[model samples]
Target: MSSNRKTLWQIFRAPLLLGLLSLTGLIGALVGDGLFDLISWATLGSALAVIAWYWAKPTV
Candidate 1:
């Protein structure tokens, strides 16, 4: 039998990064207009894409 071990950082890194990006998007939406608004939309869209991708995955 083989067992693979994962570290805390490995597990949390993606979620933390997504959280940071989403937070930045929220702040950008609040802090400015024009380019910042566009950036915020793009970042939020990327986050939603990731969520949809994960949600569509097959589970066993």
Candidate 2:
């Protein structure tokens, strides 16, 4: 991949994944499936992890 593409991905990765996982969790909750519940929880954890990672970073 080109450097610019890589930079964009790095910049957007967490927010993109967070949005996707949150959407998936919302859909799973609406559908009321046990499997999806588990998936949602896992995604939720990872989403929190991403938030924590960014939050802990020192500002430039």
Strongest candidate by TM-score: 1
The 0-to-1 C-alpha lDDT of every candidate, in the order given, reads 0.88, 0.79
Q: What is the lDDT of residue 36 in candidate 1?
A: 95
Write model 1 residue lDDT over 1-60, tens digit each, in one string.
Answer: 236887899789998998888988999989999999998998878899998998998865
Best by lDDT: 1
> Can you write out model 2's per-residue Cα lDDT over 1-60, one digit (the tens) per residue?
255545788888878978998888777766877888888787777878877988998876
Cα RMSD of all models vs. native, in order, equals: 2.6, 4.3
Q: What stretches of model 1 exceed 4 Å from their correct place?
A: 1-3, 58-60
Clashing pairs in 2: none
- Which residue pairs show collisions in model 1? none
